[model samples]
Target: MGNEKDSLRAKLSPMSYHVTQENGTEPPFRNEYWDEERDGIYVDVISGKPLFSSLDKYDAGCGWPSFTKPIELEEIEELEDRSHLMVRTEVRSKKGEAHLGHVFNDGPKEAGGLRYCINSAALKFVSIEELEKEGYGQYKKLFS
Candidate 1:
């Protein structure tokens, strides 16, 4: 556990370590991807596993990067969260188990009505143009 923490600390920035490992939240609107308007795929920062695609991203007015859903349902695990004095469903990467953020029922009604509010610190975006070079060519289909 110590070795993993050490490795993670070395790989991730302080804010990323706090958000992904410590379950800390970054300030809204000031976050990296909160206002990102690019075409790409969002992968787990630690494990590099595909999580969300820019095709599903939308401005939910929550100051965080919001997605209608993951690239694949199997890529994430939603758990009941009782922290912060409010019951919510927590989103985490299946492989990395990084704390992504929460999912709420207040998303666009036409988009399945689920808001996956994610932390930018937990993800690394691979632009559509750089997908192949980033070894994420498979996700290019989302852009097409």
Candidate 2:
């Protein structure tokens, strides 16, 4: 397991390693997926575990890829973050233990009252058409 994690860390880009391993934040608007609109599922870059879906994505005007919820509640693990002198809930990928981003209470009321402001470096988007080929065929039913 340790070797696998080391291999995964080595394969990640610098920004991705920083975000997921070191809890670093990427510049908001400049990051990928913040403005993406295509239908797809976002998975953990390290573990390939499904995290979010385009169906749950929304523009929160926060300059990040915001979602109402995870693809499945079990895929995420929340931890209390006291970094930078602010109390926040940190959301991480359960399987990969990658720090995805933070969750806030403010979000579209109709969709849900929580906003998962995720880091693009921690995720890889898999389009609906590519789900099967990418070994995520079971998730295709989400689009169907």
Candidate 3:
């Protein structure tokens, strides 16, 4: 088994750890993927599971990384979050078992109005520059 702390650290940046593991969030527009435009997939920060696709990404202007939808329903798990005197769906990576963020019903109408507000710490963006070199050559066509 991998060390939970080390595994998370290796996959996530320092800020990500604080946000995801600590149930915190980065300030708006301070996250890594908030304005990222790359070709590869975003994986789980801990276990490296492919969770969201760039195709499903969008700018929600919410100060965090938001996606229209997940790549697959089975890739993630949703729990009813009742914290802070509000009801929300808490999303987590099923493979990594990491706290990703939340899902909300209010989003762009074209994308089904479902915003998958995620934590940058729970994700690792694979850029086009490093896709092939990182053994993600199969996803190269996504950029084209």
The number of clashing residue pairs in each candidate reads 0, 0, 2
How well does model 2 score by local distance difference test?
A: 0.93
Q: Rank the candidates by lDDT, best first.
A: 1, 2, 3
Tens-place lDDT digits, model 2, residues 33-144: 9999999999999989999999999999988899999998998999999999999999999998899999999988887799999999999999998999999999888887
- Report the error of model 2 at residue 87, Å: 0.5
The better-scoring model by lDDT among 2 and 3 is: 2
Candidate models: Cα lDDT each: 0.94, 0.93, 0.81
Question: Model 1 segments beyond 4 Å from truth?
Answer: none
Q: How do the residues 57-109 of candidate 1 rate in per-residue lDDT, one tens digit apiece?
A: 99999999999989989989999999989999999999998999999999999
What is the lDDT, from 0 to 100, of the residue 55 in candidate 2? 93
Order of candidate numbers by TM-score, starting with the best? 1, 2, 3
Q: Give the top-scoring candidate (lDDT).
A: 1
Give lDDT: candidate 1, residue 10.
98
lDDT (Cα, tens digit) per residue for candidate 3, span 11-101: 6677878777766777778777888876668888777667887888888888778898887679899999888899989998888777899
Q: What TM-score do all the candidates reach, one by one?
A: 0.98, 0.94, 0.83
Clashing pairs in 2: none
Evaluated at residue 85, the lDDT of candidate 2 is 98
